[model samples]
Target: MEAALTGSLLSLSNNLDTQAKAAQKDSQALRNISYGILASDKPSDFRESLDNVKSGLEYTTQYNQQFIDTLKEIEKNENVDLSKEIDKVKAANNRINESLRLVNQLSNALKNGSSGTAEATKLLDQLSKLDSSLSSFRDYVKKDLNSSLVSISQRIMDELNKGQTALSNVQSKLNTIDQVINSGQAILKNGKTRIDRLQTVLPSIEQQYISAVKNAQANFPKVKSDVAKAANFVRNDLPQLEQRLTNATASVNKNLPTLLNGYDQAVGLLNKNQPQAKKALSDLADFAQNKLPDVEKDLKKANKIFKKLDKDDAVDKLIDTLKNDLKKQAGIIANPINKKTVDVFPVKDYGSGMTPFYTALSVWVGALLMVSLLTVDNKHKSLESVLTTRQVFLGKAGFFIMLGMLQALIVSVGDLLILKAGVESPVLFVLITIFCSIIFNSIVYTCVSLLGNPGKAIAIVLLVLQIAGGGGTFPIQTTPQFFQNISPYLPFTYAIDSLRETVGGIVPEILITKLIILTLFGIGFFVVGLILKPVTDPLMKRVSEKVDQSNVTE
Candidate 1:
């Protein structure tokens, strides 16, 4: 029993250590992502990062609660020291029997005519001592140990209950937020549809106005000629005819130009304002269709997390933050700008902003393809005779890194030659792409090497996340909170940022920072691969064996 108890403790301890390490890794990822958020100019990204932080906190809380539960179970276990209690009871029984035997000896001595002897007195004293010892043992069990156990158990239960209550409160708040988002989205969707229809018919309406003005101008000459002939026929009132004719001609000149000029001005104003109106409507639609839904999804995720946690100030704070951000976003969408006029400097290349994003995406996609096609392990060699796991990982990593660099070169050079990306610093552009490739390949390679097929799935998921959250295409702030929160953790964010710097015009400090971040990401994933491969390899092997067995059965 003791051995089993010790083993359970050891297993729990190991589980805790693993959980702690996982949490630490998550913390570092969150920190890195937070930094990415700070670097971003978009509010959407910042809000999204906050959501990720909340999720991490909730997970950490659940882990801590698991530790608490383990401790509580250990404390509440009545059988934990049952063996010790049995041993105490047995010692007391032996003493009681010895006392009874001594009493019998005294009786036998009295019957044998030795009642006044020292032996009888000694037996009485021994009996007295045994009685005292048994009483002490009984008191220890009933009074001291029992009370202590009860007190410990009660304390653990009290704390656990408190935690559960806190979590429940947080869950309720999140549900409320979800409902609010749903309502807001429905309202915005209707508004966007209406705006779209209005924009679609606006050009036809303008054309009708132009046709009416032109027809009026074409008939004005005949009306003036008819009036002049009337004045010639009315020679009896020459002065009045001259005055009337002058007045009529003056009215035509004034009214015709006014109508034509008004039409031209209206057309010009509509042409200038149409794009801004469309942009405002698009922004609102994006918020309703994309941003709000994402926020709600994140809230639901957070709600799931809170379901496992205790009610605490942290949960309250998280809910409040989410609510405030959602309210702000609602306001922005509701009060969208119809037209905004601002002075701006125009860049020669309109695509410069997006070039970095596409370049990074191409390089990442290339690495993903490379890893998917290639095997990380050598199947020919027996497991015992093969290279160390680290060696296999590093070896495969080196090959993938080279391939990634080549892919980067091909894509980057192609962008310059064919796409005319008009990169300001061609050398820096290629260098950034190479660095991005290394980072992307490292992440994909690490996953595949350590986790096998499941790792590949994770890599694919990561790619999808980065594409959405990386701020590569649209501003991260313009995206949903979940993507915004995850963008900083994604390598694509730094890669694209660095690429954009190279394409637009490099800021040496910013460029250096981005490059350093990308390098860290590569190093971080490589380290994860090194640490987790040995641990996960056996599991993967077991799964493979299970699959093979199932296939044979089929």
Candidate 2:
């Protein structure tokens, strides 16, 4: 038992590592593609692109090794399960899906000239071929009676070989694209050098013009100077000299614009040519295949070992183990399942707490407080002297609504005090929080008017519900379908969503909707409460009797 547990733990650990590596590689590949596709703008995004590419590659290799290792382990087992094999196949398919997703992302980045379009496009094509081949091959293997173990092994081997060939061809295509990107980068650098040189000359030309102007002025006769001196300077020396400097400066300025334009045109041409090269790589990768020789060899071995078992039951057990291993691997590709139940705990309203928590609390607290304060006596009411049924019900609703507003003010003030630190959308955030509080107040009041103390129990129920549907942490959609469907009906849910948006830089429309809903709920409850007040006399008497017993006991 201990050994089996150890094996399971080890397997899980490897699976986790594989996933982490795959994620890293996917991110790196994205960065590399960005660099290749957007060669012109690579200087700015180059670091990110490169980092993503390297990380993605590392992760992919790590994940692939783990997968292969797991497969080998399952192959070695004497008793294999068909279900386990199916699971493993599914896991492999999931890995393939991830690869495909990464490829697609890279292709998009390339098409948009992100970083490494050619390489990304090629990788995408290779991934596509691998997916198609695997899909068909897995189906063939599942048919069980397609051929003898040797024949099936041969077929798988051939398919895997095709896949590896595709991988090789894709690598070649990426190399060509890389060359074009490097060449383009070189040309871009040259253009920058030329532009820089021209920029350096500009200030000198301006200075030269200033000097010529000063010399022309100094040559001119002053008010006290002779007429002949002034005339000589003006006609022969100053006019000619001033014109020379002015003409030189103007000529330089005029040529600068044209020179810059030409440089820009050249850079644009290079960028355009780069894309064509990237496309060529993508086309080449499309022609390649994705095959695994190891996989085929392992399959052959497993099948041969299975055939040697004389008893059908022993063969079945072996087959079951194989199938189980395969299925387990496949299941790993999907989102990790959370078997742990939701742990309900007290949520602290730390100023940094998400909008939903505050909004929901505000609404529920306000409604109940307002209603309780308005109708219920501070001291105990007994059989000897009890508040009228009408007073108790309507009064509680009114008091809670008012209390709700006061609570809203307190929270809003708190927000204002810390708004600078974190509250991004002050107006929207406060409004939504207040809106939710009012709605919660209204809903609680309505429930109390109908069921009295039993309604307080209903508030508790709402609290549990809000925790699940509030989208405070777990997104409502990811929960059970019933919660997902019913979430919108709860005012706290909308309020929380709205407040979260406001705080998190997402402006939600639910705040306004909450207000509308709250108003409607308030009106409906008020009307219902008035209608029920006369009929609920008997229930009110019983409540008074309970109140007397409590007071007497105290």
Candidate 3:
């Protein structure tokens, strides 16, 4: 458990580090783009953008410098031979700097749109080639880092296992002494003296545990610090490193249209200088083919290293050591470690909370509605004789709607019980219930309408969609934007949102609007079913007749 948690934390920390660095790079790029788009003069804008590119280049240079420092530190402490990796990183950093310089020259070509149109075009092609090369270089660095981290983790785990075995031995002896005393075994006076002797050895055992724990803690932080320092070194010293990689990627991704527009403008500006522009493009293509593969390999190495570090056990061992020590402290209740982050998230209060009640009510109401409809309609040759289509629609709709509404109420009531009617507003709970009711009605009605036969299939689909898309464990916003857009269309979305707000103090920003939209959709569908009742009956009849005809044909 400790190892797994440590792995998770390490992964999160690594990802966070990546995101932070990426964010910083993106920020610099954004500033550059913003300044370029809003410069007082055309020349000034070009100048600012060039400066931005320069800053990025400088950052990358600093990152490389730091990487060198970390390599030196690692060599000194771990006796690891990282000369090859260090040299590769340094060389790549130098090339990246050269690329940035070329990119800056291209960026400076703005008189109105592009001053050095032919030159800028040539530079872009050169930068693209440079970009690919740098990517490969980074990959290699990342891989080396991973191998180093894996080595470190294994060492830490070995230390922890040794400590645990030593502690367990001490504990077993202490327990034996206690059992002897409790049994009133006076003949075991020598055993009692032996137990006293064991006390003298306790301190040594303690030293071993402390040494292991301290070593793990100190070493884990150092490894992380090294990774950070290395990242900063490359990022700070080599402005071109990130500019050619992340900034370029983001700009290309988020503003392809803008890039194309600017590209066309530059081409037009250099119409008189077409030969220079074409030559630049050809040179860039050639460079990409020749150099990018090596750079890409390097980047892959670096990324692999990053992932290994993120999964290392040094930190996890330290945490476990602390926990075990606390457990060993007799007569004192240990404070529990907060593993909430490691646990499943968007946490539902299922065990002793009103949430379970709400969950139960919703399921029960759905089940009852389904069963009632199936059983009621089972014996009928013509339910139409006793009821008009509109009446049938109204009766069925009313029954289900009531069931949905009541289920929502039951869930709300359960929430109240679990929360003990806390200080949080009950209004949110009510809203959740209402939203849930609407969602259930729409979903049930839709499934019944579509399936024609109501049984286990509709229930399964509803449950699966609810679990996956209902925002139970993870917010739909983190999902694909397509799902983010579509989740609100799901009934469970509102139920989770509103209930979360009421019970968990997670009031949604757009709850009112979402509820209104959901309510409208629910009402609209229900009304549509009413108007289309005659149509549905005839369709059902036709379907039955077709089935009977098939039977006859058979």
Could you tell me the TM-score of candidate 1? 0.38
Model 2 — which ten-residue stretch has the worst lDDT?
144-153
The parts of candidate 3 lying over 4 Å away from their true place are 1-387, 418-423, 426-431, 449-451, 454-462, 477-485, 506-509, 545-554
| CA lDDT of each prediction against the hidden true structure | 0.66, 0.57, 0.57
Query: Which 10 consecutive residues of model 1 have the lowest summed lDDT?
Result: 197-206
User: What root-mean-square deviation over C-alphas does model 1 reach?
Assistant: 44.1
Model 3: what TM-score?
A: 0.32
lDDT by residue (1-554, candidate 3, tens digit) is: 23442353244324423433443353345344534444434444465656655676667667666656555554543356768757776776666566566655556555346545455445555555655655565455356544554554455345455754544444454445434435547536545543443243223334444676654553455445555655665567556665778888887789999889999999888896888989999999988998788799999998888787668965567567767886544323453353445432244434323452345346436744664455313245576577766666566666666667776676667556765544255766665666566556655564465335542366566566656666666666777676677676666666555555555455456667656666776677666766765676567667767877887632
Q: Please rank every candidate by TM-score, starting with the best.
A: 1, 3, 2
lDDT of 1 by residue, 1-554 (tens): 22333344444445544544444454454444434433444423334443454455455446545545434434333224334433454455455445445544544544455532344355446645654664565465455544544544444334334544433443454445434444768757655653443244223333433444454555557545654654454555656768999999999998998899999999999999999999999999989998999999999998977875555666577567767799766765787576777624223476766788888888878987887788877665676466877777678889999989999999999888888877878998887788888888998888888877788889888878888988977889999898888888888888888888877777889989988988998899899889888888788889878988888633
For this target, which candidate reaches the highest TM-score against the unseen true structure? 1
**When superposed on Cα atoms, how far off is each prediction in RMSD?**
44.1, 40.5, 40.4
